[model samples]
Target: MDRKEQPLVSIVIPAYNNENTIIATLESIRNQSYKNIEIIIIDDNSKDKTLQLVTEQQKKDNRIKIYHNSTNLGMIGNWNKCIQMSNGEFVKLVCADDLLDKNEIEKETGVMILNPSVNLVESDTRLIDINGKKTGSFKRYHKSGLVKGKKIARTSIIWNNFFGAPVNNLIRKSVLDKTGYFDEQFTYILDFDMWMKIACTGDVYIIHELLNSFRIRNDSNTGNLIGKDRETYVAEHQRLVDKYAGELQLNRFEYAFSIWFRKFRNAAIGIYLRVFAK
Candidate 1:
């Protein structure tokens, strides 16, 4: 495809200590069916070989550009840097350890072009264990086709729907310019908060096909949080509930009950994992 014929898509990968999985992740992007892509990798001062591996890969593919931080920028900080470095019409963030289907870029970009009103496009996600074996399916907003921004926001918040990880979504550059990127304050619920904000800003399109694999590893951030730092998870979940209470139109009782229910459920899950899972 000529440079002018195909629009550029920027895929930003934020990496820390992911030496073991970084190669496979990069390979997935390099093998994508979409030919016009710019792969930007931001290494957040990884103590391991993550940067070295990415640098070597960058030497081979002109499309892949690697940037290293002199000091650790943390997850949110590095993500913002990735956004700043991207120069594509469509942007996607693929974690260092996750995998994307070869055709994901092609399919998602086509969807975005065909539906001009949609600012965000998300697809069904599948789960893969540490060994890359298929584990299960990830939940997504059920309704497909063009969806209203306010309705998507309200239903996702009120009905307890799970918006899969950022890896499953493709976002427009214009929307990012309007929404102003992910809020850095959110620790666990950053993606969730961003999704809600994006949905409220404009239309969202959902694709029913599975286009990415979210790897489940014990060392991953969410895994570490859920395993030993569950209190942080519970706190962040509560924070989001509190922040969006008015948007969901929750009455006082409904707000209080939702908070209580979330606390109870999270506490129970933590206890169960601590006991029998041991």
Candidate 2:
């Protein structure tokens, strides 16, 4: 399809003190094969050179729209701000430190355009380290196709969030409106919460291809949570399971299983990150 004929996609980036990786993240978006996109970046009062760097990039690309928050709005708050500022048929929340494959947007958009019933489309993710070295890959489904929203939600409740990160997914703005924004009550599992909500609304399309890279840095939020405040991270996961238990009609056995499964999963992930991801 001609770039002009394509629907506009909004790539909303919520950046804090990400001066190191912000430029790379922006470049990844700018290099996408999908030309019809608006790069909306919200700087959440970064204490570093994030704002200045983004401003410099903005001058080169007219499609880049930048906003600076007077005061620091925590991670989730900044994410919501980006969503509010976006005006596109589809929305993608890319973190300041992540990178995308050149054709990521083009392929994901094609899936959404072809499957109107799908409110979300997610692909496999390549995992990279702080130095941008390939560490591993995250591939959930064995095959790529449409999955029932309710089934996905239920599975999440039982087995924990397997939807990967925001970079791995593309969401319809209309569905986000219906599902609402990220829950502020969550710190570590905010994306997981939002994914479950979006999945409850409509079917989710899964693409088996790896279209994005999730960077793992020791100073990153998830990294810090898993390293220093692991107890809190586990608590947040439990909190979400509790919040959705009743709505999903989860039984006592299922609830109990979720709690156990999360602990096991956390342990396994920790081991993987330590042994292979390092």
Candidate 3:
């Protein structure tokens, strides 16, 4: 596709000390089959060669824009800074360690343009290790086939699906204006909060095709927060339930019970994983 014809895809990558894997991640974006892209890389005070490597690559590629946060703004602040700089109509919140498949942008972007009801579109991902070896798979809001709004709205099936990973999809820039960004105070569950807010606004579609490689690391937030993570997630989930109390189709007491049920189920999964040595 020509640069003028391609949808302006804004990729906000929050960088910390990803010196080893950042290059391959950005390289994947550079080789994207769908071209026109604005990449805003926020280097959040990495003591390693993360920013240095980007600067080297920056000189070679004009599409790569690098920003250095003076002190550590943390990932959330770095993420917000990238969004502020993006001028694209579509946005993808990619982690510094994750990678986009060669055709993911074209595939996901096309769906959103054709499906006006879809405010966000996501697809399945092939899981990988830091060494770029295939691991398993990761997906959020996945279904056997294409899914849309009313189904997404009636229940929290999507949340129950992948446990809530934000970058599983490409979101419209306008939706951010309506739903707001990640909750700054959340040490975790920022994506969960964002998804909850988006779910209430419009249809969120999950593509059946695999579109990216989501790297799985032991120390990554999701992996680290296993058994103990539910408490924090539960707190955030309850806040969403309360925030959209009217839309849940249940009274206050009923809503609380539902939230409790979901949390208990998540905790059970964590316990099982722990016992099974997964």
Cα lDDT for residue 250, model 1? 68
| lDDT agreement of model 1 with the native | 0.81
Candidate 1, residues 1-278: lDDT per residue as tens digits?
56568889999999999999999999999999998999999999999999889889988899999899999998899888998899999999999889999999998899888988888888888878777877677766778877776676766665554566889888888888888887877876688888888887878888888899988765577666666677787677667777777776767776666566666656664554444331
Q: Give lDDT tens digits, candidate 2, residues 1-278.
A: 99889999999999999999999999999999999999999999999999999999999999999999999999888999999999999999999989999999999999999999999999999999988988988885444699987787888779757687999989999987688999999988899999998988888988998889999766677667775577787798889989888878999999989988877777677666665543
Query: Cα deviation of 66 in candidate 2 (Å)?
Result: 0.5
Give the top-scoring candidate (TM-score): 2
lDDT of 2 at 144: 66
Clash pairs (backbone) in predicted model 3: none
Go through the candidates in order and give each one's C-alpha lDDT: 0.81, 0.89, 0.75
Off by over 4 Å in 2: 275-278
How far residue 31's Cα lies from its native spot in candidate 2, in Å, is 0.8
RMSD of 2: 1.4
lDDT (Cα, 0-100) at 15 in candidate 3: 92
Q: State the displacement of the C-alpha of residue 186, model 3, in Å, after optimal TM-score superposition.
A: 2.8
For every model shown, the clashing-pair count is 0, 0, 0
Candidate 3 has an lDDT of 0.75
Q: How good is model 1 by TM-score? A: 0.91
Q: After superposition, how far is residue 36 of candidate 3 from its true place, in Å?
A: 0.5
